[model samples]
Target: MKRFLIFLYFISSALTALSSEKGIIDLADYHYNRKEYYYSITESMRYQYLYPRGELYSQSMLITGKSYYKGGDSGRALSVFSECYNRFTDSEAGERALFYSGLIRIDSESYNYAAKNFREYNYVYNNGIFLEESIINLSLVYALAENYDEAGKKIAGYREIFPEGKYIKQAEELSVLIKEAESRPEKSLLGAGLLSAVVPGSGYFYTENYMLGIFSFGTNAALIYGIYDGYKKKKQFQMIFFSVIEFSFYNYSLAGSIKSAHEYNENKDFKKELVLKFKSEF
Candidate 1:
């Protein structure tokens, strides 16, 4: 009975894999808890391979995604997380997949895609653990991406959905900062140059450099007064020399003011982006 023997061998292999399932899952979890992500990844892969139809199939896939993420393999982590939920829509692991997928997209600076993922999570898993966090972060990502209009909508959604959400205070503060950020261009080349030309230090003030603005005002005022004094003294040599100095100093101040404004805006935007990025990491 060659066919019967072959069937018996298949049955034995299935029984052996079934018995090993508990050990496989346990070892994976043990390694994961110890932060041995690479080792955890190996065990998870083995379990998935041997137990394709196991009860823990979705959990195994989730473990694999988490391990890849912990091991600093984000692209791989995203891939596995997507596969987990795509394969098991009804499992709790699918809820986790939604959150992690959005998180990884944020880390990768794919803000729009991250927003989409978070939205899906919010709609599908309304009672999920990370829902509040997802809503708050979704608004931040849009702001960070410079899509302020969409960010504003997200804030409205946050308030409507969570009038006194956990992150309410945080969201309010961020909104204030973002509103301030939106009030003016970081550096307006034409604006800076025009302001500098009209008022020696006003451009610097507009750029929020008070000290430099004061210095520019004081320096230009002194030089201008010196030229005037020399002219009134009827000293030809002194007048010419002081006039030239004043002219050059005033000209340089105008250019410097514009440059400073540009730099100030650039630095401010950079810092804002950094703050947004750091929030995503946590």
Candidate 2:
């Protein structure tokens, strides 16, 4: 009777421990669903502490990393995700971790690193759940970096691999945009700088900033008149002051024109639109 009671007690204790572990994970998941990222992280970490080798260990790590990410602690999130990926490389959680790491890199504007992560995920998990997402995002990363050729190739590959993929429409749209962006004429920074040097606001005009060009030209013209008047009156202090002001304005116009030219060449409007679309879609 004593031995039987002891055996029963051990079974009950095991069941209770298992139940506690499950309860912690469930609570963490509930918090995560509610977007209570801090509490989710707390519960997930508690699970990890109480059940280091628990069957739900991978899930707990994933939740902890995701919570950190949703809470805007991207650095910590990346670290946790990388750790989870390393620990459970063949698991679903590891695949998601790798994919999310790439997304975090994209948010940071680290396009090269994002591309690497996405590529790695694609290569490592050919049939992974995030395969389609990784492929599209990889192409987008290249597009963002202005690597049109590579971007096009990736999009084509995505189409070939997933003929009826959910992202086909997006891929096609991005492809058209890429072609248009490539065909657009890029402004010359050197040309803009030279124009401004020769004609106070001509650079701004070349960069299509007519209002700024007009303001720059008017200001310089007025300053030139001031200097001329000062010289004619033989006023040394007035000439020096006008000369300083004109010099400063001329430099400002020149720099502004160059910056405008660079921005025009970069096609910032297209990039801004693309980024917004990418964020909304993905």
Candidate 3:
């Protein structure tokens, strides 16, 4: 009875191993055919563990990466594709790995990094799958980073390389906007003071700086009121003295008002320049 039990146990263990192997292969085929890529990836990975040196090893990795990509896991997809590219450089699957890697980076908003990877792939494979996309994304990154000069250079490069690209018209329009902004005059707060110096209240008015103008006018009014009030009190000597002082200071306020305008204009120039620079790059 003990010998019979041992034989039955051996048979059961052998069948279990065979069934597991069959299950892995069947699940892989079923999931792949049904376009359930996420499941296909799991089954394929299991198959790899069971048969590390199987003929399907490289193909399985490619499928797993593709599944991750389609399942909206771009970061993981990129990692897997990078591994495939490094581990199986001679395989046909490896040829496309870098191309997909660039796409994943671009999708993930690592625009500058994507551009570098794409450029490398293009250099090696001349006719890389996503060359135009790489160029467009590189241009966008420089623009977003406020590097207008470099961004402009990149746009020029794109025009030369892909004049008929799908987004050529949009790129051209953006270039024109940058040029227009670059041509505008710059403003500064100090310039407002200078404007006020040249013409009382002029600087504030020029910069649409009405509050400062009102404040300047109010100070003059207060001095004038003080002079008149002193005179109305019937203090003859005091009234004359206050009147002269008020008159002189009123003139001084006029001069200061003009200086304030100049400062306002200077400020305007600076702000205008800042806005122009930002728009040009972005």
| Candidate with best lDDT | 2
Models, CA RMSD each: 9.5, 5.7, 13.2
Best candidate (score: TM-score): 2
List model 2 lDDT by residue over 79-149, tens digit each.
Answer: 99899999999998899889989988887879999999999998899999988888888888898899999
lDDT by residue (tens digit), candidate 3, 1-282 = 999999999999976764475566566657767779778888878878987887667666777787787777877888888888888766666757776676566456575776677567657666555556555555554554445687688779879988898758766865775565456454455665565555445555655658866765566567667767877887777777777876675556555555654554344344344334322110
2 versus 3: better TM-score goes to: 2
TM-score of each: 0.63, 0.84, 0.45
lDDT of predicted model 2: 0.89
Task: Report the poorest 10 consecutive residues by lDDT, candidate 1.
Answer: 273-282
Count of steric clashes across candidates, in order: 0, 0, 41
Q: Determine the C-alpha RMSD for candidate 1 after optimal superposition of all C-alphas.
A: 9.5
Q: At residue 169, what lDDT does model 2 achieve?
A: 95
Ranking by lDDT: 2, 1, 3
Ranking by TM-score: 2, 1, 3
Model 3 quality (TM-score): 0.45
lDDT of 1 at 176: 74
lDDT of each: 0.80, 0.89, 0.65
**Using alpha carbons, what is the TM-score of model 1?**
0.63
